[model samples]
Target: MEEEKRRLIMYEKLMAEIDLGIHAIDDSGKTVIYNQKISDIENMNPQEVLHKPVREVFKFNEGQGSTLHRAMTEGYDFRDEKQTYFNNKGVEITTVNNTFPVMHHGEVIGALEVTKDITRLKRLVQENMNNGTRRYRFQDIIGRSEPLEEVIEHAKRATRTNSSVLIVGETGTGKELFAQSIHNESSRSAGPFVSQNCAALPESLIEGILFGTAKGAFTGAENRPGLFEQAEGGTLLLDEMNSLSPDLQSKLLRVIQEKTVRRVGDTKERKIDIRLLATMNEDPVDAITNGRLRKDLYYRLSVVSLFVPPLRERMEDLAPLSEYFISKYNDLFQLEVEGISTEVRKLLASYHWPGNIRELEHVIEGAMNLITEEKYIEFTHLPLQFKRKRPRPPEHNEIFHEEESTPLLKDYLFQQEKTFMQRVLKEHNYRVQETAAAIGISRQSLQYRMKKLGIQKIRE
Candidate 1:
């Protein structure tokens, strides 16, 4: 009897800890087990739902009812069926449920359900549908480098025709910016422009999102137009297209070829008149070799391919990009920050930007936030993480005297302390109180150190 009790406790603990929601009910529709996850998803307490009928605890619109109840009564099983219903508190909840009938002695006794909450995703999709404004233009692209200009010229030409364009570049290389520019410059500029990241959602959900679902298609699917249909007259930019599964790549290829999309679980094909743009973060050849992208789809989409060069490949644009970002943040933060210092510029140019322009923008933004009553962004203003990227100088023990070739430990320590104090003082904008607190020293001690070290705020 003690062993049986321990096993039941273990089962209850497992159910409570699992990420997915778990709920079960008896044949008479009385709630038997309701885990914490399900309670959280439904926004109801276990005390309110336990030993109560599902119909009494939750409200479902006519023709759309509980999957658990259906599984118990009809002996039916549902897989990846989306259900939207109101809980006892009158809060609407959306979930993807897999329900199965529980059987004992050849008779259905209850039903069990596992659910995944997708309420946030549903709201995001709705927001994307409502907000279809095209904000980026060709002029918005910042670089004037040869490689960037060449790509811009090609993108400008792509806008003349409705050919599908494939953009290839590393991550953070502004592939979406180019895609948006092309769409805004295209003939369909007046129409709705929608962009979706193919990797943002799972295959099951993405398939339905990309291709509209018909009513009666799944458990709770409504008659809704997909992104292709929503972007009827404009361009649809699918970011990270290479992340899509091979099966989806095939379906996309068919749509590109026929200019029509068949809704999921629906036979009727609807024609679409819109330009398609896709961006891949990796090389297309690599993606195709790895079987993540379909060869046929690549050919169809690459009718007009534009390769945006990474920031490392176009170093000439660094100065202009940096200045532009400074001006942008100047207006944004309402500051008169004139420009970056020469030392900071050298550091910016020396680092190979693995994250490309986005990283540079963020670095500048961060440095600007630390500035107050300073005209130029200095080396000290850079974030600590970026500062760590600077090349390490010789260690104190490694520094040798010219005559003895022995370590100058005393001189090295004095220089290091002076540099550290100066940097900390500058970081706090020459505020003695803040600098003292930052360095964990009393105000008098910090003042004496500054006097001994000859560290004073110097304006450029």
Candidate 2:
């Protein structure tokens, strides 16, 4: 009996430490029990709430009905963020709330409530609306394309709401670039942007990276702010959030809910104010299925989801992109090469670019360095193994000999002419000018054919 009493006492203490704003409404619609979070949100003490009518305590409307009462009578779960009418202050407060019916054995007895304050978010939203333009908008995104335009548009929407974001794509797809653009366009743009990669940093170092420790917290310790601290009043990006263990995901969930972080070897929790963005190379759902990514963490991140398209899908930017990279590398590598050979473009377009834009950039830089020329790049300047040959057209010498000017078949000759052009490109190693000159065509005309054939490499 003594042990049971002691265990009961410990269990009650455990319930008191819960961070969620737990509330209990009896069948009579009176507040029977409330947790610290609820007390703080309602600006009332537990004693004041013990038996007060919920309507009087919360000043809820009798006609519209309380979400809590609805949950109890209907035995349905209620959850959402809404503007709730206040009695004491006569003002509305936006609350992230969850209400569920409480039952003993199999019988419903009351309803439990959990509420969180989002008033600060409201102010930030209002200020942004009045300004008519955010400090960080989509214009900051450097790319111009249908996909990129859509991505920037979503980033703008994400800033208006304080929901977490998850960016999923392959490596070198500019995940971090997009992540930063989102942050810069968000309400927290003025604050520092802290970025960390779970795959880059080991688990042993992740905790310290997230929650800073004191000077003596560990052996070689110096008082340093973790990424979270640096990102306070700004944004923190975990580039590989799925790499975190299940344990870290739980800790992260607490931080998201409470907006606080406690340093290692510390006794008190420190508050943090920042937005969060995480990235992944794989589907978050798959990660969860395999136990690599936490489901709760996935839920938190997927509130605002954006997937960057692979470069192969954005072929419209190929030529301009090649030019862009050429110009960029021209300054970086100190080269005067105008651009890649026409054949080089065809060669690039023919190969399956699995590596995406990043791969294209590297190839351009590689070819530029190998050329060592000032005028124009040659087909041989590109990676040779990637070049593929086009089939040659059979000579129609019999027809040419049939008459001096046998009825000139235009489109048929054009088809044969186009095929001949492709063969010429292969011969010149896909160098545009070389292929054009060989086919008695100009570089511009060749470019038009390449574009017409939907041939592109190194998408812009």
Candidate 3:
């Protein structure tokens, strides 16, 4: 008898320490056990709820009552049901509950309920939905290269209809730019435009955030509209769509097919009138082959696909892009910078920009910050990361000269020209225009000669 009493005490201690809210009642609907978690969730003291009838301690909405009461009296089990009720103090509480009937020899003895509080999560989702806005449009995209223009044309076509779009590009290739441009150009321009990075949140939370939550979808889930509902009558850009789990990808495919969404843990489905745009940083074929993406979902989202070309593929746009960034910073920094020097342009063109336009913009921005009274961005102004990748110019002592045999006239002339240009540039403190004036040649002529002779200003 003492052992049984000890075991009962141990059980009570474990119940109190459990993370979930636990509430149990007798067949008569009177509370027999009320744990601390439930007390916290309901904002009620255990003393206030213990031994009290559930109907008297809490008030449910019309047509809804206690899940524990129904489970005990009706001998039924309720799984993942959302319940909202007011405590005796009139504070409203929302919970996701799993209520089960406790049976003794096939007869209902009582009921047990396990619950999770999600009131805060619900409030946050509502606040986020109310605050989001779209800022990018087609004109905001900068490049004029054929590869960029071709994709823009396709994106424009995407705006004419409500077809799902899959935008494929490398990181920093501006996939979201096209997605926003499509929305702003389309008939849904007046409505909300929402974007969610699939990789931004964990799988468990993302499901509820994307599809919305029904008051009791899961622990901490509140009845709130997801990204789909928030972007109603407009566009929803799912950036890095391939990052989504396969199960979610399947659900997304279903939503695309049916044009409807069912909130997490809710039985009813609501029709959504929103355009879907998804982006992938990697090739969809590779993503599918590696099992990171679903083939069916890929097919669904690719109805009007676009590939934003990397910066390396469109070298012609470099000059214009650089000029644009220069002008942008000139206004922003309140400076009078003219343009990039020829050598700086050469260095910018030679390196392969792995981060694409974004990297180029950062390089320009970094250079802009270092500018004081300089008229143009020079080779010295470029970032060290860029300089490290390119071959460093040979130092004066490192320049090789023929010693064993007489050199060819072309080779000897090349050496002489390189040596002369290096000396003149050093004298002018590596100023291109000043060096050109000292040599009695046009600035463009001196620049061309320097390029041919492999002459570059060495950093001091």
Candidate 4:
């Protein structure tokens, strides 16, 4: 009898030490074990709860569902089921419960419930739901060019509201950085800042990802929240928005207008409240003309549009941006590098950085990795591609070489036309609508000529 008492005391002590709330009920719905954790979680006295009817102790409304009651009567089990309701003291609580039916001799005799208080966690979820964290601020963006300054100023003003913002720029132009900065400056800064790149995702899965999936909607589909729902009361950045399919674009427009989303294969709409920031490497007009983007959606998203200038247009910022990258990499690599060679700077300035800021950062990082105990980045340390000299302009004599045979008029005219088209396309950063507008032609006509002349579109 002494040994049995010691064992009972040890069991009670073990139950008291557990963090999870444990509540048990016998076949008559009378409480059998109500651990200290359960008492604390429910804010009730153990003496007041002991041997009481389970439904009465929990204050379960008549005809309302209760997991422990279900387990006791139906002999079923539930795991990780989330329940939210007001307690006896009128305090709202959210909890995840795992209930199991106790069986003896092939008959259910009682039930045991394990619960975890998730009220604080659910509050956090409602406030911020980004998968990870955002680490960018306005000060992190380094630039001084006029166009860049204009973009930065516009972006700062966009943080004042929950309205949608559309950012247009070429690849490597720091679109995502701008998005993060805006989110950090907004009222929703404490909330989540989620981002998704439409171009990086497969076409078939984009819809399900942005919306959500209802249980039994498809193979392996469960009742899951989507980016929009997850970003409730926060910010959602949709990068490369132009790459989304037309069907998806239409649905996106509806969501933006109604502030509600219907999960895939689910008929009911779930309302959401979130700020939107979308980025596109191509011109929105081009996307519309090509039927790749919906016009209404573009208009809705462009409530406040900001455009980041390309590196070639913002050459003045190259030096500052390079210096910034150098300083960043120095800390990252634990290097004492101070500056770059004059020749290296000249080379960087002269060469058009087709990849913009991202490419510049890569070049600096690669050079930093190669340098050891060097005070400065030398010309030799530069990438081989950047080391190559730019092709010199053709001399007057070379253009009209006396020794070379004169070209045919048709060939000469065709070459001139192709060269002009290529220059215009490059000036517009290969954006179809902008190139067409600049070259005084329709998008369709330019596309046809590009196809006929074998001029390939440059990838952003």
Question: lDDT winner among the candidates?
Answer: 1
- lDDT per residue as tens, model 4, 1-460: 6999999999989999998899898888888898988788778788877898866755554555778888878888987776665556767776778899999999999999998875643443343354447579889888888778878898999889888999888899999999999989989988878888788666655677789888767544458788898788888989899888888888999999999999999999998999999999876666787898887898799888787877766778888898898999999999999999987776676555668889899989988988999999998787776666342122211222334444445345656888889998988899988888887877856875674344888853
Return the top candidate by TM-score: 1
Task: Please give the distance, in angstroms, between residue 232's alpha carbon in candidate 4 and its true position after superposition.
Answer: 0.3
What tens digits encode model 2's per-residue C-alpha lDDT throughout 102-194?
988988898987776555334432432333123333554345777666666776677776688999776766787777777776677777777
Clashing pairs in 1: none
Taking all chains together, the TM-score of candidate 2 against the true structure is 0.53
lDDT of 4 at 198: 81
lDDT tens readout by residue for model 1, 299-353 = 8998888878878668789898999999999999999999989888777776667
Cα lDDT, model 1, residue 387: 91
Considering summed lDDT, which 10 consecutive residues are worst modelled in model 3? 391-400
Model 2 lowest lDDT segment of ten: 391-400
Tell me the lDDT of model 4 at 38: 77
TM-score of each model, in listed order: 0.70, 0.53, 0.59, 0.59
Separately for all candidates shown, the number of backbone clashes (residues 3 or more apart, or on different chains) is: 0, 8, 0, 0
Cα lDDT listed for each candidate: 0.84, 0.69, 0.82, 0.79
| Model 4 spans > 4 angstroms off | 1-132, 389-460
Quick one: RMSD of model 4? Answer: 14.9
